[model samples]
Target: MGRVRTTNKGLPRGLTIKDGRYYHVTTVAPRKWTPLGRDRSQALLAWAKLEGSEPDPSIKTFEVVSLRYEREVIPTKARRTQSDNLKELERLRAVFGRVMIEAIKPHHVRAYLDKRGQQAKARANREKALLSHIINKAREWGYTDAPNPCQGVKGFKEAGRDRYVSDSEFRAVWEKADQTLRDAMDLALLTGQRPADVLKIQRADLHDGALWIVQNKTGAKRAIEVTGELAALIERINARPRERLSAWLIQDDCGKPLGTFAMRSRFDKARTLAEVDFQFRDIRAKAATDTGDLAHSQKLLGHRNREMTEHYVRARIGERVQPLR
Candidate 1:
């Protein structure tokens, strides 16, 4: 037999087992009245054991946990990764804000995924993955004892893009692009680097006829051997008069580095003007195609694995094959 207590409201206090019913009360507001099912005798014994052990802290609402995660966990990621995660968090907070982290069930996760999948399957998939990370963080923080709700939810399959930019298309876009956009495009095309890494380059990165870069995504170091047009572009970029010398190589109309969003919008405008059906990222694949050497392209792009480099470059089947006659 165990001592049973009551609140001032004539309700069970904490986790109580009496009168063949089990009432599990938690600090999570929406989850205040949780029925841990029948089996009163077993509930009493479990409650007694819990009382004798260390006090378990109550779980917070998803909103509170999300704020904490943004403050703590989000900063640990790379800038581009952080930006994408922040967007996912925004959507998650809208749906799961008041829900108790521990009380989130697989059905709720399935429902959310279903709703988001309607708008964009790819976006929904990203959100699902981000949710798993958030749930894992909640578990790590001791906010939830429940298994991750996102674990069994099926993500919508997305088709892989095989859009490769042609050299003539690159030239068309370059011709139509403004000076600032042209500089960024040329750098990306020449180095076969990600737009984020390209924007991070500074005047100091150039030395001994090579562009030294520490990739922000993979943290891999590379010194791209500069020759021909790339070297000439760097020379012209350096010679351009500046109001104030900025550390960033790709400068905006003002002498500061252009932001990711602004650069993307500018590139979109250039694409429209040129009428080219390709993105800035496609330029990396284009660079890979031009090299005609997989290992050289992999090193140039600073991809630690060949698989990732393969994703960037398209295979030239014609070059590898004799006439199939």
Candidate 2:
């Protein structure tokens, strides 16, 4: 015999009979559940019992929430930011991928911070920040109702970089650098631009002794005037003939754009040869110091505000020391 069909003559407030089945309506999550039978009275009792109650461990695991975050959240960030987040996510997955979202506590965050801080304090701070953002996103997306574990964690004190490359050190690195590294180094020193912007420079970007660049991170457009040695160096790179010409101004032997890792590695090799203890970014400060003009350096570096430009302009020490009369 077929199942008994229940008529909705006196069903209670949270129970409804549709077709031949009775469903218990849930109040908390706005969902319906099957009571497995067609008895309207029993189903109504079940609905009343389950009303105003939370589901058992409705939160997803860390891996599940993180995957969702990677899909929906990470893509919305800038390319450089997205790359950084992915790296942080990789580290997080190894530590907490299998753990439940609600099970994470402040102690776990502190432990991660302590261990990572030992390696690099700045990196630890960044990871902790990223962790806080990810957990908050999880709550917002309904994956978990737990508090963010990283909220109680403290960031490390950052000692910002102030090691500007001196003229002597710059000459040493230049002498030791190969052709490709020399090209990159010259452009960075002349324009006071980031390595990313320097690598993205194309032959077509040059016009009438000036190179127009749109900074990737800040989106600031500036026309950098090339003259003297800078103009001569650019002319040399442009004059190189290729079987299939590349668009990039900074190219490898095969006429292709140099990858960031490759460029850094080559630059590092040159630094080691020269025994210099400064980074490629320090070239910007050196350029700013060489100009002795804040406004001109700010414009060449494409800084929207003078505050950031000031950071790159190092003071010429001992130039104004008062002698004892």
Candidate 3:
């Protein structure tokens, strides 16, 4: 009687198409729609499960494994990494959601890279890396026994950023920065820490005649000895008038802890006024290069190896060399 069941004639009862994808329409008074993906075969398998019928043994969708990964594995990563992984997963799901987990091959990954790389090469590389990790996790979770398709597929080569902020450039930005921005800049440069790590610095972290730091990204711990300019800087920070007492070393005018977003907003305004091309993060590289001692810079920057420190201390200006006689 339902108008002779016009479209999708072969579809099972309660399963229908909507907006280019298949959905299972609930039979109850308040109808609920559950997405079963766009592929006919995959959609039918999903409908079979909803109907309490046994699904085919050989068919397991990538969407199934990816959803499981999102529910289980993605939560264990760092906050920023988790955010990035979710975005990458959404993109991957759009292409491979209906494909069988075991059916993905190296060529499929390469094809994805070829297409995605056109828009953002570096971002594509990151997405591919996340996909590789997801597939590996799928294996561990018993979703699929197939080998990772991302393996043997090469990612595009990426060059490290080599923008070195010169002394004049530093001074330009510094002159334009407010007191709060200046404090952040000074701390980042003096401690040779990342912006996130610098923003997390607290009063309790200062002890044992040093400013103790636990890097957010690497979990590396360091105790930068509080002396000379660093000692004076801390004194200056402490002496600043505040309406309310705060534990965080970096606070806004109202004594609220300065967050990365606020700090970045402030930095952007200052950088625009100064007309400088460099970033707030460049201060760390400047610190490493100015230290002039490889070993000392390595320790100061909390790098595990000398080579890693060398990447940060790239010569922005002309390299100094002995003149030929």
By TM-score, the best candidate is 3
Per-prediction TM-score, please? 0.76, 0.72, 0.79
Which pairs clash in the backbone of model 2? none
All candidates in order of lDDT, best leading: 3, 1, 2
Q: Which candidate do you rate higher for TM-score, 2 or 3?
A: 3
Model 2 alpha-carbon miss at residue 242, Å:
4.5
Residue lDDT tens for model 1, 10-83: 22246654465776666456766556556433443444454464223354778767656665677677877877
For model 2, residues 1-325, the per-residue Cα lDDT tens digits are 5334255323334556677787876544757565636543344345546554422335477766765566567766666777788778778877987688878899999999899888988888888888888889878877778788888677889976777677899899899987878889998888888888899999888887788888888888888777888898898877766555688999987887888999889889888999998988778777777787778878888777887777656443223457798
Clashing pairs in 3: none
Cα displacement (Å) at residue 276, model 3: 0.7
Q: What is the C-alpha lDDT of each candidate?
A: 0.77, 0.76, 0.83
Among the numbered candidates, top lDDT falls to 3
Q: Which residue segments of model 3 deviate by more than 4 Å?
A: 1-59, 315-325
lDDT of candidate 3 at residue 305, scale 0 to 100 = 97
In candidate 2, stretches whose alpha carbon ends up further than 4 angstroms from where it belongs are 1-58, 144-147, 207-209, 226-229, 241-244, 315-325
lDDT of 3 by residue, 15-126 (tens): 8998889999998779999999875556766776787854343557777677556656776666667767767877998899778888999999999999999999999999
Give candidates' CA RMSD values in order.
12.8, 14.8, 7.7
- Please state the error at residue 270 of candidate 2 in Å: 2.0
